[model samples]
Target: MSRPIMSKATALKISRAQFDINKIRFFDFLNYKFRFLFFCWFDLPCYFISKGQYNFAARVACTELSSYAAMYFLARWNFKPTLFVFLLPFAILRLGLMIGNWGQHALVDDVDPDSDFRSSVTLIDVPSNRFYLNDGYHTSHHLNPLRHWRDHPHAFLTAKDRYSNEGALVFQIIDYLEITYRLSTKNYIYLARQLVLIGSQVGMSQEELAAMLRLKTRKFSEKEIAIELKK
Candidate 1:
């Protein structure tokens, strides 16, 4: 027997319906938090697996296992205890990166999930793109996922107008710490103020935008929210 396949429209309908239901129950807050955590921990492995990159996954697993073994031996014989203690901050920094991934794409456009420009934010403040290799131009990277990172800025510049029209969110003078801190503190108003006409493009009134930005508010019913989104 063949398995049933859902059409794109059907999938989108179901997704929208679920979005509405989550809004009604005020479950989106918890859902986003949980998704944020899951993405941090498992997104890379799961993405590789989903793309049938089994060899990549195997290599990563082996590399991680070998690193663990090396660390164990280093602590047991070669490394001083204080050196290991000093490395703890680096471990915490890695953990923080997991949460940072969540902040990057947290405010995806409701009407354009697959639109690269609308679905991700671009971080513009970092002095140099050397460490991240211009990945701060996220929408450009998304538009051409396999393109060389060095080419991202060109891609972004080439299509700057379209991105602006689509209401793509860009942080002109903010760093990762600012993004993470604002989100952690539920400072949505401040964050929303930074958005470029997203409220108007999404047909969200000021009040509705505020309500949507809040972490735990359900001022609109699921039907109403869905209607507004469809607009």
Candidate 2:
């Protein structure tokens, strides 16, 4: 697969910001670049339906509608006075869920993309994990989703070699939100710096590691997903 260089727009964007990551983040916030994606709930039902999963899609659609209806009724049908109040927490929760998922599964290996360890990430020292209860062990969650939260880290440690073989990525002192931001901006240099070398990756150079990470972030086609799923 061909790797993409930064686009002209991206070049201009970085230039305008003087290559500052914080400025890029601020600009992206003003642009609502990820907000639409963060509201993944809005398109999910339609997405499922398009893939010919009518039952699950219908349930999702109906449940979403009913939830909104309940919220509106709770607000006494007053949009200005109370709708924002009701939506405040719900929107926050939804955005968090979507953003976490995005960050978790963002770096799927171009090869072996179907491997759970290869697809999701393990985050250490992320503050939200303490509050959200094991949100940081997303790779282990994907490995066996029903596993109790407390056992997640243990599981990863036990299968450390497998994770290393699958080329799993881990980060310390970085939360999912920052992961999402870094990936969105294609800041591979920063990501390479943060990578926790589990096994085979110990001797890799920053450029080589960045290239691998960049390749993982590329969008897979339906054909690619279908191919991956078969194996």
Candidate 3:
């Protein structure tokens, strides 16, 4: 599969066009620049690290920490009160994670069973309809950040859409979230607390969270499936 690269032209154009001219103060622009530059600097390193190069992981970590430092300096520049307010908790958690030894366990990938030991989705390599945005596995995310695989008709209609057709191993989102969130928030009590708060804010009940966790680790038993079907 062809890997996706965020185009510099696209990034700049989007940044300038989407941003409010009057609203973006000097500090806001600086923060935006910080985020963009950090993304650029770490992009290649992240790819290399994902390829199993330990040295690349170290380099990426170093650069990522530096980028976060830059982001901190530029945070005050942001003028979007609403965005800043919404981002504060996540941002603060991220910054804290970057500092502690717990940073070693930072979660990088999506919460997918297919993502656990390896990738879950298998695609046709023809690259015809694959515009890298709509179909290009990873690039598609850049194009449509919120488009979920489950929402696709081909996948949603079938009992084994991602699992069988795409060669993906489907698992409960709650399961993925619990493991990843716990690992990422290790030693970061504020983040741990924030996670609980976020869970509550999202309207997930404790029973639901436990059920998801159980599903994540438990293999799919035919009996369970039968029981679910009966319900």
Point out where model 2 deviates above 4 Å: 1-65, 229-231
Cα deviation of 17 in candidate 1 (Å)?
16
Question: lDDT tens digits, residues 1-231, model 1?
Answer: 111122222223333434442233346534544543334234445445756877666665566556556666767775676355634554555557544544554554555544566556787656535576775776666666666778777877787778778767666566555765676666667766655453234666656554554522223346644554463
Which of the two candidates, 1 or 3, achieves a greater lDDT against the reference? 1
**Candidate 1 overall lDDT versus native:** 0.54
Which residue ranges in model 1 land beyond 4 Å of their true spot? 1-43, 78-89, 128-131, 196-231
Alpha-carbon runs more than 4 Å astray in model 3: 1-90, 93-118, 121-150, 153-162, 165-167, 173-175, 181-231
For candidate 2, list the clashing residue pairs, or say none: none
lDDT of each prediction vs. the true structure? 0.54, 0.65, 0.36
Which candidate tops TM-score?
2
Task: Sort the candidates on lDDT, descending order.
Answer: 2, 1, 3
Write candidate 3's Cα lDDT for 156-230 as tens digits: 234333233332322221222233344333322322232322212246554554443333332323453343334
- Report the number of clashing residue pairs per model: 0, 0, 3
The TM-score of candidate 1 is: 0.62
Q: What C-alpha lDDT does candidate 3 achieve relative to the native structure?
A: 0.36
lDDT of 2 by residue, 9-119 (tens): 222222222222323455444334344334334555655665586776787668777876788787876766564666777767666755555566567666665567766
